[model samples]
Each structure stands twice: as structure tokens, then as C-alpha cells.
Target: MTTIEKALIRLHEVDAQSRGDFLLQTLDARAKVIVTIAYIAVVLSFSLTSFSGILLFAVFPIVSASMSGISYGQVFLRSMIALPFIAFVGIFNPIFEREPMLVAGDLTISRGWVEFLSIMLRGVLTVQAALLLIASTGFQRVCRALGCLGVPQIFTTQLMLIYRYIYVLINEAIRMDRARRSRSYGRRHYDLSMWATFVGQLLVRSVGRAERIHRAMLARGFDGHVRILGHLRWSSTDTAYCILWIGLFIAGRFFDLSSVLKFL
Candidate 1:
């Protein structure tokens, strides 16, 4: 299968997983969303010199994956996609700032390298926290949770629409490409001219599809709000879930466990 086909399959698989009756999926969307936000906030609040303390935050995702019935391999693989961007932004740190921050016997480590690793840890933590949220809660309920959290309805509506639009757009692209491939005599790849034609056709088709979708929404009375079935309840477990994670996050932000370890 082609790259687009594989991507579509992965997308569908993730969607399927989100709807599963696992631990995290069973919780209130608002509670999960709030905990995710708080988790990310704490992850970002760590000092740049904090490597060991930040490492402790990995427990959050570990526990989440364990309870949520989502495989660690799957989450780890998905999380790696964002690493290239971090590498691009962070690759310069070691070169620009060469001053040594720490020394151990004959070995020395520069402050720049330390900062780069710190940034990478933060990126990974935040990304996993986000991926866990979407993978466990799905998109629609995430928006519902955001709405409950006092986010503007218009913003969440647009976010959901964009997600749905991109999904449809990918399907359109896959179909168009397949049609082109079927007509091609022996060509393995499209030429520049073919790409130009493909994009032009895609644009036109996308416009038409958008219009159709808009009309359908209007017919259904989509007035800047999306309502899904079932109500979100804040059970005692959800309250404890929030308190436990947030408490850990706050502890992470204030206390450096690495120092404690070294002291001991």
C-alpha cells in the first residue's frame, strides 16, 4: 500500500482505540482533559537544569498507558514523530554554548547539551501527555471537555471542524491518487506537471466538498455548537485522579528529587 493508505489506516486504528472501553476512556472527558492540561503545565515548569526531576514525570504516561490498555510500544512509536522537529531546533545548542556546566573526573558536560536534553525531555512529556489525551478521549469529547472548561465554543467548534476537514481531505487525496495511478501506464511517481494538475484539481474538489458539508451542517442546525450523546459526570475516582496527578505535578515543580537522591 501507498504512504497515504498507510496513514489513513493508522488514523482509523487510533480512532478505534479511542472509543474502546478502557480505564482512561471510561473517565469523564473533562477530568481527563483537565489532568492532561495540568500534567503538561507541570512538565513545562521544570528548570532547565532539571534532568532527573523531569525524568520522574515519565510515570504519568506510564500509569496512563497501563490503565488505559494502550500499548507502550504504540504510544512510544507515535511520540517519536515529533522528535525530528525537536532535533532541528535543538541541534544548535551544543555548538553555540560550549561552557562546561558540570565535571565528573576527566569528563566534562556543557550547559548547552544539558539544556538541549532538558528541552527534549519537556517535549516528549508534553507530546505524550497530549497524545494520551486525544488517543484516550477522542476528538469530539475533547471539544466537549474544553467547552466545559470554559474555552470559547467557537474555538472548539473550529478545532473539531478542522480535524474533520483534514480527515476528509486525506480520503479525497487518496482516492484521487488511486485514480491517477490506475490510469498511468507504467509511471511509478507523478511528474511536476502531474503534481500541479493534481493540486489544482484537489483545490477545486475541496471547495465543492466544503460547500456541501456546510449546507449539510446548516440543514442540521449546526449553530457553532456540537452536541454528542451522554453526559459527563465527575465521579469520586475522577476527582482523585485529578488530585493525584496534579499533586505529583506540583511536587515535581517544587521539589527536585534528584537532589534528594544525591543527598541521601
Candidate 2:
């Protein structure tokens, strides 16, 4: 198959997975959305000094990714790429204010260092929460959830458009990469100018394609809003899940269970 065709097939596979009827398929989309948000809120509320608490909370993403059939390695790789930006912005806490605040037998660490570590942990927890949310819930369901939550129609529509086009852009980039490789006889060459040219061409093509898609939407009676068919129902299972996690989060935050464990 051609590169574009292969890319299209892969896109279809992802869509199928998103819409698939399976074991957890019966779970209400709204419940998942609410629980996912609640999960993030709980994770982010952790005390910066609470290492064990953060570690315990990490199970959510790991389990969610595994259960969703999404590759953990892929999520990790994406996290690695996206996380450094946050780290760089937050790492300054450890750089200045070098006064010794805590003694660890032979070494003294400053309060600044502690704060910086807390910031780093916060970033990881927040990012992982978001990653799990997207991977498990899928973009379409997320958009629907957002709409139900009273996010403006324009914003939801824009989000939907972006989600739909992201795969298209990815496919375009992959096809371009494949074409480049074929033309170069399968030799890996990093030509900056050529890459820039290819990206420019892809951007132009994507814009043109978006125009065509817009026209197609108009032809099908899309008048600034697309009706989503699925209705969101919150069930007993969702309520239990939310309450359990929220209770755990509150207990962990207030009780400092990790510190108690250390004393044991």
C-alpha cells in the first residue's frame, strides 16, 4: 500500500478503537469524563513534599493505559517530550536560595530545592493525568463531555475540528517522510532545508484540504454546529469510582499516610 493509504488505514484503526463496542464500552462516556477530571484534581492537590502519595497516585495512569490497550511506552515517550518544557519552567526553585534547610545525615538540602522538587512532581502528576484522560476517553468523547459541561459551542466545535485534523496532518507528515525516504533510496538523511520545504508544502496542502472539508460540511447542512448522537448517563459505578478516589485523595492529603508509613 502507498504511504498515504497506509496512514489512512492507521487512522481508521484508531477511530475504530475509539468507537469500538467492548467490555468497558457500556461505561457511560459522561461518567468517564467526570471521573477523569476528578482524578486530575485529586492528583494535583497532593502536597509537594509527599513522594509516596504521588507514587500511589501514579497507579491511575498506569492502570488506565494498560486497560485501554494503549502502549505505556508510547505514553512515556510522549510524556518525556512534553514534560521537559514544564520542568525547565519550574526548575529554577532549586537554583537560587542555597541555604541549608534540611539535613539528611551528611548532606544539607535547602528549602528552594524542596520547593523545586515539589514543582517537578506537580508537573508530572498533572501531565500524566491529562495523558491518561485523553488516551482512555478519546477525543470525540472529550469534546462531547466539554459541550455538556457548558463549554461554548464555538470552542467545542473548534476542538472537534482540531481533533479530526490532527490525524490528517500526522498522516500527511508520515507520507511526506516516506516519499523523502523513497526518493533518497531508503538512506536516512537529515536535510534541514528539505525538511523545511516539505513542512511548508504540507501546511499548504492541509489548508487546502481543510477548505474542501469545510465545503463538504456545508453541503451536508453543517451550520456552525454538529449534533453528537451519544447521550451521557452517569451510573452507580461511576458514582462509586468518583467517591472512592475523592475520599482517598482527601485522606491522603490530610492524614499524610506516607509519613505514617515511614514511622512504622
* Poorest stretch of ten by lDDT in candidate 2: 17-26
**Candidate 1: tens digits of C-alpha lDDT, residues 1-264:** 888888888778768878998889899999898898888888887778777888888989988987788987788778888889997898798899799998999999998899889888888888888888888988888888888889998898788888778788899999999999999986878999999999999999999988998899899997866776887888999999889889878877787766777866
List TM-scores for all candidates, in order: 0.88, 0.75
Best by lDDT: 1
Q: Local error of candidate 1 at 143, Å?
A: 1.1
Give each prediction's root-mean-square deviation over alpha carbons. Answer: 2.5, 4.3
TM-score, structure 1 vs. true: 0.88
Local distance difference test scores for all models: 0.86, 0.71
Cα error, candidate 1, residue 86 (Å): 1.6
Regions of candidate 2 where Cα sits further than 4 Å from its true position: 1-26, 46-53, 63-78, 184-200
Q: How much does candidate 2 score in TM-score?
A: 0.75
